[model samples]
Target: MAPGSSAFKEVVESHPKQMNHKTLKMKAESGTVKTSMSLAEKHSIHGVHELLQCPTCAGSMYPPIHQCPNGHTLCANCKIVHKCCPTCRFELGNIRCLALEKVAESMELPCRYQSLGCQDLFPYYDKAKHEKHCPFRPYTCPYASSECCVTGDIPFLVAHLKEDHSVDMHDGCTFNHRYVKSNPHEVENATWMLTVFNCFGRQFCLHFEAFLLGTAPAYMAFVRFMGEDSDARKFNYTLEVGAFGRKLMWQGVPRSIRDSHRKVRDSQDGLIIPRNLALYFSAGSGQELKLRVTGRIWKV
Candidate 1:
């Protein structure tokens, strides 16, 4: 019978009938307490999670989360390469734990990234998967592919971008940046400039590009957060373009870094200026193109 069940309670009641009545009652009560306490222990973070953790790898046991012949548990991750239990040195293999699996199912646990601001609760089976893409999770170096392996929060990422990528950093949430495409007539489509804006302790990238939209030469500009789209929606940006008393404005939530600036631009989700309009903003007699763009970002 499951511990603390009515049947188990009856078994405890059957104990020591010949002993002193008071002592006998005390024994039954102690047994009741022990079994009742097991429920709390079985579901506690410090208790069950610790028990589930592999002795060697310290990973949580999720039933074929593995076990040794003598009943010590190990996570599935630690089961391979070691033939014996690390705790008891007993031969380890094929030990099914149907009872504990039921207990694991009964408990909801926080993601491993809980310390990083994730409040999500999940069963053991879903915790790791949710954490992998959790927005609150610390970001890896945006430049990870180049082997510049550093990781931290958003502020740390901005600092890394400045120190390592040597990316241009502009001050303030509001900006009046002048983008110069010097050769407006160039047939090639391209990204002209990228500026990093620091505000609200977060980093946003301003992308300026010159491209052809359906055979119409144009320029597109937009903002994207250094994090994921889910995070980007927490804030919004406004882009403004125009010089001679007329202005075109686009305002929207910043896309996540996962969405390439080109994707945002091609989505027509930002400010777009056609060739004629772009040239009018150009200084130096239209031979060069310059647009004095003004914009601001604020938390939504």
Candidate 2:
């Protein structure tokens, strides 16, 4: 046994089986072992095995890696350690592991709100953006009490409020068909009238609260309903324009007065008066309506 030659023979002669066993044990403990049956295989068995185990904890790995302050590779459990990097003392703000991020990106994730009709899939990084604008996001209409049941995206909501929940805004007089005057009595010259009809068939009469001036006009209106007192109830439905001379004349004679006649007429000609009748208009300046109605109305 010459010097180097004797050393090599000794190494070869040593228990090769023991050496292999030690190597396998070490690799297994590190979660890096794989069955290499051939030089090439269907999948990279070692890489696949490693993929299944966290490089930091040597435990079962989840796809996305939550990271710490210092760019230390960590398993989810270790990654959450006081928000400090496990490998260094870096203070973490909001760290994310690119390696795990890439893994998550390659995997398909369904929208969190998918059950609510959101049919979008997104990579890990884009998840927040998709969630922010998902069509299934829940929202409530601002004018919910005013017969507006519309609900949807912000733009849709705004359009619904403008087109459906809007009340007829009047820029001119609601009666006399004239532009509203600086004084309520001055409104007598204007013929335009304003009214709001609720879904419940109740009627409200509107009048100018202050003089019409500048671009917008000030307005005031009273909502009237049947009262307990007969006298009060007698004028219960009266929408008086006062000095403005704009009056909404409902069929003053109640059904009690015309019921007999109406019944006879219906028996003869089948004519009927609608139970709920109301009108809508703009008073002084801005005029718009949320619902359709009948009546010869105009804006002054």
Candidate 3:
């Protein structure tokens, strides 16, 4: 081999690993290391989302992310319960993963309820807040009976209530019904009836229940719009019950079923009748209950 070529070859062979490492060190120190960390990259969003997921809970990591001595990180909620790194079993420390937190601040993500028909993108910081109030969030079954665990979007829940729960469905804004019971005095904290009424291309739930209003046994009747609260505000309803020339009426806005039936009932924002008054309106002996309820719903 030529003299110069042979000398160069010997130098390269003597410390090849060290020379390559020194070059990499220089690139890193100068902030010129070629990396796929740019946000402009096509896969960067997905990669960042994956990176921010807590190893322990698989949830997106928020602020105060804690790290173990070996650089493994977990979310704040998991940190409180975990004594070691979930990823590497390394002993955890009080160190916060500030780098990861800063990275999250620079990102944007689609709503977690995108599959539920929410077509909105939010910055990482505002994502949780938007998701909390997202209209497309799944709704629990509105069946007055507390036995149903079903939850889904409006159409799915509507079908579920009809087919699975066998709930009555009506097609009018005005309704009149007679509720009869064998024992008017045997009042308990239980749901009595739930009727679905479709009007103005929307659905409403008329809920009736017997519960203790403070210390007195009372019966409550109310209506709930099966849509978002904002849309529910566009409508109002009136309920009236009468007998023996005496009548009781309540007029108010229909609450959104987004508020659970129990929640609305407990709020007592509906027409409530005391057990004694209800029996007085009955057609027969005080032991039997036969009360008539008439209501109308209108767009406001």
Candidate 4:
């Protein structure tokens, strides 16, 4: 071979074209030198291109950057005539494009829900879509009713119930009993009688008990007493029968069989005995069944 050809042959032998091709193939397969620009670089280029586009006259735009209320970034030309965002008609505001600044700086973006589901990295603009469809989003209703058959998200269910089923909602002690007084006499004579056998001389107690169908947790037994015509004294008693009667022990009275009474000092149109008095049964008959009630009463 010629003298110059000899050096060229040596150089070619040392660094073969096949070796270079192999190295390039390995790099391509390993994805080290990507063919296309990265997502962040692409976003930066697009953002810059958009910044240069004129929104008002279809011409090129010039900075400083402004944003609409809907978060659309626009140039100064668009802000002159447009009090609102050109794209969404939202009100415009003076805002900086820190995101574009960040993109220009080459900061790495993360996948939305990286703390929830995903660990993969992504461009900042792609994060919104990822988070919108995240699988682990937590949801709960604010109004959860334990007693009724209603169950749903609180705000929606509360508004629905208020509008459509307002009458169904009631406020009171859930433990109290509701009854219509059929016999006024039974109610009037409630304070003095040992046992109110009838209401208005009618058997309303028996009917009330039967109407309850044994489902009530407690029984309400009203009793009345007749006093001589010295002064018309009235009494009302509401005996809480059954296990619930045990609560009366806190009132310094035997929850089982207790005696209590009040005397009428002044004449106030006869004594008006309050209802809701509790009574306990004595061991035997003729036990002097005292009235354990609260209210003024004249002693005969």
Q: What is the full ranking by TM-score, best candidate first?
A: 3, 1, 2, 4
TM-score of 2: 0.26
Q: Which tens-of-lDDT digit does each residue in 141-209 have in candidate 3?
A: 988656777889888988998888666777777888667676666667663677778777778888776
Judged by lDDT, which candidate is best?
3
Q: Write the per-residue lDDT of candidate 1 for residues 169-275, one digit (tens) a residue.
A: 76567877676654678734534556677666567787766678989888887887887665577788888888778788888888776555456667988888887
How does model 4 fare in lDDT?
A: 0.30
Give candidate 3's error at residue 141 in angstroms: 1.0
What is the lDDT for 182 in model 3? 67
TM per prediction = 0.56, 0.26, 0.82, 0.19
Which model scores highest in TM-score? 3
TM-score of 1: 0.56
> Which lDDT tens digits does candidate 4 get at residues 32-130?
222245777759756764554555566533336567656676666667778888788777777765664454334333333345434444333443455
Candidate 1 local Cα displacement, residue 133, angstroms: 4.3
lDDT of candidate 2 over 1-300, digit per residue (tens): 111111111000111111121110001111112222353432453454455455557764454565555555556676565566545666655555767556645543445565555544454345556666544554444331324455454345445544664534222212222222222222211222223322121122222122232333323222221111121133322222222333333222111111222232223221111111111232333232111112221111
Pairs of colliding residues, candidate 3:
none
RMSD of 4: 36.9
Off by over 4 Å in 2: 1-66, 69-96, 144-300
Point out where model 3 deviates above 4 Å.
1-42
